[model samples]
Target: MPAKPRILFCHCNYARVVPDEVKSSVLEGLCKSGQAFDAVADLCEMAARRDPALKRLAAGESPVKIAACYPRAVKWLFGGCQAPLNAEHTEVVNMRELNAEDATNTVLNKTLTPNLPADGSVAKVEGEKKI
Candidate 1:
């Protein structure tokens, strides 16, 4: 690979729900859209996987760039990355918040924001970090 871009997905709670078919479709669309890398799924999976590669990227790369579908995803990878990565590169797509599901409209609206502590700690509901 020719210097692959470092893509991270922060606080992607819907990872389990994001159907593989949708993922493939989005990736195909992205490939057609432009020259953007097809590392979206990998990045998201890595974040979910809590891979050390994220920290390595922050340590080695300059102008460490990331294109996330969610800003919380950035925050998720931020502390673990071991460097002060820019917040700008992170993008937050309000799927649960903005997409506005009609079925759970009442419940979702009340719980839109990311589940975070006041001290900025990710309230670990699931998944364990691999040592």
Candidate 2:
């Protein structure tokens, strides 16, 4: 059976929305380069759909796992993905803040950082948060 896909988030360090033009350019670059991986500009929005943990949060229920302790800000973006993810394999970069509104002008010659494991395994991205 084909293994489940790993997921990762490339977050901007800055706390702002990356321009739509920048996002499109990045995706185009990835497709042109023949790289493999899913990219989400608004991690929170993506998390809200795919992450079971974040789904629970959306439902207003508290998560039981240690992941319940991470700050909402850190998790608000990634907590929604389904778990059993390869811990050593997954990572989230702070990119929003770095890219900011000027993302179009700022060149990321290297487009779309890898967000998942190559082996197609799912992995957790963050720790728990305490209420």
lDDT of 1 at 2: 33
Please list the residue runs of candidate 2 whose C-alpha ends up more than 4 Å from where it truly belongs after superposition. Answer: 1-16, 40-42, 49-76, 80-87, 99-131
lDDT of 1 at 119: 32
lDDT of 2 by residue, 47-94 (tens): 545645444323322111111112234433433354333233323333
Predicted candidate 1 versus true structure: per-residue lDDT over 9-35, tens digit per residue: 223334554444434443444445443
State the TM-score for model 1. 0.41
| Residues forming the 10-long window of minimal summed lDDT in candidate 2 | 60-69
Reference-based TM-score of each model = 0.41, 0.36
* lDDT (C-alpha) at residue 130 in model 2: 24
Please report how far candidate 2 places residue 9 from its true position, in Å: 6.4
